[model samples]
Target: MLRFAPSPTGDMHTGNLRAAVFNYILAKQRNEKFLLRIEDTDTARNIEGKDKDIMFLLNLFGITWDNLVYQSHNFPRHRQLAEYLIQKGDAFYCYCTKEFLDQKRELAKANHQAFRYDDDWAELEKDKNPHPVVRLRAPKEQMGFHDAIKGDITFAPSEIDSFIILKEDGIPTYNFACAVDDMLYDIDFIVRGEDHVSNTPKQILIHQCLNYDKTMQFAHLPIILNEEGKKMSKRDNASSVQWLLDCGFLPQAIVNYLVLMGNKTPCEVFTLKECMEWFDITKIAKAPARFDIDKLKFLNREHFKRLNEQDLAVLLGYKDSAIGALAKLYLQEASTLNEIREKVDLIFAKKGLLLAQYKESAKTENAEILEFESQVKTLQDTLLTMLNQDCSKTEFDTFKSNAMQNSGLKGKAFFKPLRFLLTGLAHGPELSDLFPILRLYLKDIVRN
Candidate 1:
């Protein structure tokens, strides 16, 4: 079994989603059951409704799980396991006060040495303190595990201290709760970020103390870095999955880009289902992956182009295939749906001629601004007349011909004003092409 255990914190980070993608793909590839474990034991830090938000994001990306479990629901099991360790002499109650431990930690820091809890406090009588935390009696022997991605990792006994299992408030710490639950759920395969490498040895100690013999496979993916080569954080707007979706990135494209990062893939672009056919967790690189927005944009555009015309139109807030085709024309210049939508909206919006800009350019060329305005008026009048007569039969070439003849202007002088009056832009796709697709709306275009 494979499990994705995410805490109910704030917005889901891209790095976290990447881990989920890997776990989901690996489970499908091996035909194993995938589980979603919401690690909400740390209630103090969890946000309300964030768990639902996480599930929604996972569903949006098509990452399905076979089982759903919340860590908080297993509090009784966690406490039961802690008590078992204490009764078996593998753990003991530590009656050390907070101030005393703080002093010891400070002294260790002053001596430039790492702090390891001394078991002297465990010898205190149980009646001496009403509230005490349970600490595992860590073995002073080397602990090691073979990671699928990092391979053969070992931790010295000194690095594995007698960490707390259950707090004075009866709350299980992360490692304790996670190890017990993994054992209970029979999760054989674990895939998570490399930040959890330090906690692996502690959890290994927990499993050993409990005498759980089942071997658990682990793969710790490398960290994702920002453009500045530092660890990506939530502060970066692009680090959040919701932010990426709001920016018009397709869910499939996001998955494709994430799976392609620091890993070898069969091709540049593929859906989650296609990726499942060939994904190999062991083949992923140990080096950190960099989040490249430009690469994601490229992949998003590729995925966008694969959509059918009607579907694309619906995404752009339209139901007409011609509008979809018109939007596709801007694909050469725009990389996202929002960008293309803006371009299409401009076609229907009232013309916003840059009169100040045109006047400035006219002054630079020693030409009359009034002459330019007069030519624009002439073209508008002629086009409106043509539309009034027979809007359906008006061809772009013939329309331009009549406008140039009536305005007594030619080339850029005539075409520039006409283009601005129609599309409100100095330059864009050829009018001959744009006009035909926009024929249905010619009356509105010319009159407005």
Candidate 2:
């Protein structure tokens, strides 16, 4: 089994989502059961409904799991396992107070040495204090694990301290709860970010103390960095999955870019379903992956192009295939759905003409600007009347031909004003190309 264990602390980060994607893909590829474990043991920071939000984001990217487990629901089991360690003599209650430990830590710091719990209080009588915390009697031996991505990571005995398992409040610490649950759930494969690499040895010690013999596979993906080469943080809005979606990025495009981030792919673009066919977790590079917004935009555009006209139109808030086609024309200049929607809205807006915006373009005399507006008004009236007629026999070329002849204007004078009238923009796709896609909406365009 493979598990994606995330805490409900805040908004899901892109790095977190990437781990989910990798885990989901690997689970599907191997035909193993996928699990979503909400590590909500740290009640201090968890946001209500944040767990649901994480699942919603996962669903948005088409990631499905076979099981859902919340760590808080297994507090009994966690406590039960902690007691089992005490009975086995692998752990004992420590009567040391916070001040005592703090002094020890300060002494070690003063001596320029790493502060490890000396386990001096292990021999003290439990009757010394009614409220005490449980601590594991960590074995002084080398601990190591073979990561699928980083490979052969080891830590010396000095690094593994006798850490706390149960707090004075009787709640399990993160490592204690995680190790017990992994053993209870029979999770054979674990995939998460590299930030947890240091915590691996502690969890390993817990498993060893509990006498759980099942081998667990781990893949600690490298950290994701921003353009500045710094670690991506929750404080950065761009790192939030919801922020990216609000900015008009398709979920498919987001997943595609994430899967392609630090791994070798046979092709540049693919869907989650397609990724399951060939994605190899072991092949991911150990180096940190950089988050590039421009690269994501490029991939978003590619995914946009793959959509059918009808589907693409629906995304732009339209039902008409012609409007969808018109939106595609805007793709030459607009890359996102929101950008294309702005262009399409201008076409059908009740009042989109920017006469003042046009006036700014008239760098000449005021009389020249007045003349240009007068000409535009004259042409607008003429086209509104002309388009209201049959106009069925007119193609783009012939339509412009007739408009030029009737307006008694040619070149920029004829084409420029007509372009502004039709699309409400000083620039866009060629009129010859735009006209055909927008043929059905010509009357509304002119009226707008």
Question: How would you encode candidate 2's per-residue C-alpha lDDT over 278-380 as one tens digit per residue?
Answer: 8989889999999999889888888888888899889888898778778877777787778888888887754324766667667655886787687778788
What stretches of model 2 exceed 4 Å from their correct place?
A: 121-130, 351-353, 356-372
Q: List residue ranges in candidate 1 displaced over 4 A.
A: 123-129, 352-377, 389-395, 406-409
Candidate 2 TM-score over all chains jointly: 0.93
Q: Provide the lowest-lDDT 10-residue window in model 1.
A: 349-358
- Please provide, for model 1 over 1-448, each residue's C-alpha lDDT reduced to its tens digit, 9 standing for 90 to 100: 8889999978899989999999898888778999999998887899999999999999999988999999999999999999999999988888887877888899999999999888876755456667999999876889888998999999988887788999988989999999998999988888999999988888988998889989899999999999888899988888999999998888999999999988888799999999888898998899998889999999998887888878889999988988887877777778888888888876676653455566666666444667777777777777777676765667888777877887777997898878877776677888887887787877766554
After aligning candidate 1 to the native by TM-score, how far in Å is the CA of 19 from where it should be?
0.7
**Cα deviation in Å at residue 421, candidate 2?**
1.8
Q: List the residue pairs that clash in candidate 2.
A: none
lDDT of 1: 0.85
Candidate 1's displacement at residue 375, Å, is 4.5
Each model's C-alpha lDDT? 0.85, 0.86
How many backbone clashes does every candidate have?
Answer: 0, 0
